[model samples]
Target: MSTHPTTARPMDGTARAAELTARTAAGAAELTRRTGTAPCLATVLVGEDPASVTYVRMKVRRCELNGIRSRQVVLPAGTTTDRLVEVVSGLSADPEVHGILLQHPVGAHIDERAAFEAIAPGKDVDGVTMHSFAAMGFGLPGFVSCTPGGIMRLLDAYGVDPAGRHAVVVGRSAILGRPAGMLLLARDATVTYCHSRTVDLPARVAEADIVVAAVGRPELIRGEWIKPGAVVVDAGYNPGNVGDVDFAGAAARASLITPVPGGVGPMTVAVLLEQTVRAAAVQLGEDPAALGL
Candidate 1:
């Protein structure tokens, strides 16, 4: 809990993401040159949640910039789960759609899981399907959840190996916290998951070499709880650009910490684009690495 200032370096996810995006763009271009069609991503939006709409718009813009085609499908908020699933299934079966992204929080009554499961595993670029989860958990060759995958890329870019380290992830949501812990474990890190039922969460965070704040609470992980020199990655993006970790406090103790707005957020979209290109390359009978992905 030392308040003294420390020389903590910020994990520059923006720069890292830019580098990845550049590589993916080249891959997409190369794939397009080889094949007659460009890599296409189908984005399905149910209802017009302002935030979700903005997110999808940003993703579509990125696809345009990266030489990937984007198809937008907007449905009414009151759309039935069965109908949504049908739409997703149609997209999954489409040969032109190499990647599928169904914006989350479709609606309260919508069976989000059912819609996600409807996506073909090969086209689940967002990695929301159970097949993607299993692949990530097993370290198999498949798409990773965007945010968790971005976090891993950040760790690698910063030369922070997870092997043999104690990693504590504060949150247990299936997509963010749980998948993050599984990804860390796949890399040989001893992982712990903290949730609403966890007791003395700070104590757990204090013992970790790596701490991931993904509970979607503003500044929930106090700086005092961060172990000295630990790498802190705040994956949660709450209102007003605030993250789950107290960035200022954690920065004082962490050797490396990710910022709220420019850190995990940019990387998530970058991973999605990269995976989309990879999916297209695979579906087009080309090797992803061949295109520099």
Candidate 2:
């Protein structure tokens, strides 16, 4: 493990993400050179929600810069759940498309689960599907939910081993909280999950050696609740650029902490691109290990 400072040290996720991106770009270029098929990620978007549009554009731009191809499939706001599923299924069946990322909040009416299931497990780079969750739980090979995966990477980069630590994940969202806990458990950590119904949330947080605030509510986990020398990963990005943990207070107590905008956010997209390249390598029948992915 790495030595911890007296005060909280910023995890610097943006810098870490850049490191992953550089490696992924090389893997992507090498894959293309060997197989003549550029790694491609298909992003499916429903409706034109401004935030979603901007996020998709950012992902596409990143893909372009990293030597990965991007294919966008847009659907109307009123598109039926089945229609959305059909589009995703087509992308899954497309041999050239190596990874599938279905942007979420696809309107309240759309069956988001069905749309997610339409993506083949092999191409689920964003890791929203149940198969990915199961894979993560069983320590099998599969793409993980990007945020959770990124969080693990951040922990590894900081040399904070989860083994034998009590990790409290305060959220139960399908893609974030639950998966985060599962990943932690797979690393031999004693994992506890707390959600909206969790009684005395602060008390639960206070006992953790590692705290992951993934619930979207802003500053839900107070700094005073954090144990001294604990590692805090604030995965929440609420409006106004605030995190679930009160930054100043948590930073004062924690040995390591992730900031709101740069901490977990950049790592999500970096992992997405990294996994896309790996997916392409697998689909191309090239060994990812041999390619150094």
Candidate 3:
């Protein structure tokens, strides 16, 4: 390794994710040993959106790597809300399934919240369900939405303290943006959420001590818009895997920044695997191994 210190802190999600997967592997092994059933996540994808397909595949592949089992269920674009709910509800009732992660953008016609509600709260590892949302807002124990959960892990691994900081989260989607803001709030950060309709997006982003780019628009946040030495997190993934922030520009201005492909992406899968293992152990009537803490 080069001895020269990096002027800009590269939040190394690459290395941190390696460590998380290692632990998840062990957890999977222990759960399998005790229950004779591997921990499994049932992924539900509605429609044939290419990005949604890629995301689901990525999650399943990661599950395999971490020694967890994943089951995929695909529905048609024309699938109705009730039909989607039926599939999700069935999966929730399946004892073999420990967790359910339903991908978003389930077509405009489908009632997204209703589909999310079909999964039992305990099996809602993705935290898309109302129960998970309420729990997160209340700072109670529950499965966190995976992306936000991943973001939290990244923050922890980077030693980025959010206490008393201003955290600006762009996007208000249920999974990533909204929950991410709530998480920061729970950590004592004053949080603000901005979206396309926000009057002054640039001003809001520039004000953040911690800027999370969850809005899907590519490079919508400019370099000059960034606060010098602020921490920048690009949670957005557009075509060609580009993130929401202009990486090159943001990286130069940010004291710390997370890269697109390696940063939040890896953590999302890691959180899913972690939650899957935990859900499995709980179903087995055993506490998730927390190093005996």
Candidate 4:
């Protein structure tokens, strides 16, 4: 392995996210001017987990910054799966709502998939439904899970081509890991998924040209495993703001790496706002690209 001190360049997501958000804000402003309807995102939080609450608050704040309206529905912890579905379905049917986000990890008794499926496909800007997953996998036009979608955008911003590259994604959760791998695969990257059960995880990771750490285990992917000149996208956000990859260690070998807080996090909200604007434009029969989105 080439051991020259990693010429790793920081992929400054904060700067890129700000640029995208500004673009989205401009598009939203134009759309509102033409249609007299501001783009709106409806957020449904099932319980009051502190982290989830904080995340929702951040999203709402970003919406405000982008000139988008936000509608919040806070449900009790004791809410049943059926009731949760009812609530989300109501938001899905609301004509004024352009995008729907259901905060994840609802009560254990609630059927998460059932609740996610209740969202209308058009309003599934969070990309939790089967339709959205299929759309992303097939490279069709549809909303994507914010984090994965944001990762793709980050790659685009940095001009990293996924075509014919080996990408190893750690973790297989529906929202982050699985979709991330699918999205990379759709872009023609050879993809492999490693979870807690995978054998010889380090060896598998060392073979990758691109590594996406989304397993949510802090420092689970050690620095030694990072290939020289690889691009590392650490998508994990654990307690204490730690990511799955050892930042310092991985950076020593990576050509590009994303920092935990400033990396994938900001991009997620930016993509959500951008997609909400697109959804609104579609609903209004306006071309989002023509609005310079």
lDDT of 2 by residue, 1-293 (tens): 22342479999999999999999999999999999999999999999999999999999999999999999988889999989998999999999899999999899999999999999999999999999999999999999999999999999999999999999999999999999999999999999999999999889998999999999999989988888889999999988999999999989889999999999999999999999999999999998877778
In angstroms, what RMSD does candidate 3 have relative to the true structure? 3.3
> Clash pairs of candidate 4?
none
Q: Candidate 3 lDDT, tens digit per residue, 1-293?
A: 12222235777777888888889899888778877889999999998998889889988998988778989999989999999999999999999999998898889999998898899988988888888998999999999998898888888887888999899999998888999999999999999999989998899898988999898999998877878878889898888878899888877777888887888988887787888888888887878965120
What TM-score would each prediction reach against the true structure? 0.98, 0.98, 0.93, 0.98
CA shift of 21, model 2, Å = 0.7
**What TM-score does candidate 3 get on C-alpha atoms?**
0.93
Q: Kindly list the per-residue Cα lDDT of model 4 for residues 1-293, writing each as its tens digit.
A: 24455768889899999999999999999999999999999999987999899989999999998889999999999999989999999988899999999999888999999999999998888888999999988999999999999999999999999999999999999999999999999999999999999999999999999999999899999999998989999999888989999999999899999998899989998999998999999988999999997
Task: Predict model 1's lDDT versus the native.
Answer: 0.93
- Candidate 4: TM-score? 0.98
Evaluate candidate 2 by giving its C-alpha RMSD to the native, one decimal: 1.8
Between prediction 3 and prediction 4, the one with superior TM-score is 4
TM-score of 2: 0.98
Q: Give the runs in model 4 whose Cα sits over 4 Å from its true position.
A: 1-5
Candidate lDDT values, in order: 0.93, 0.94, 0.86, 0.93
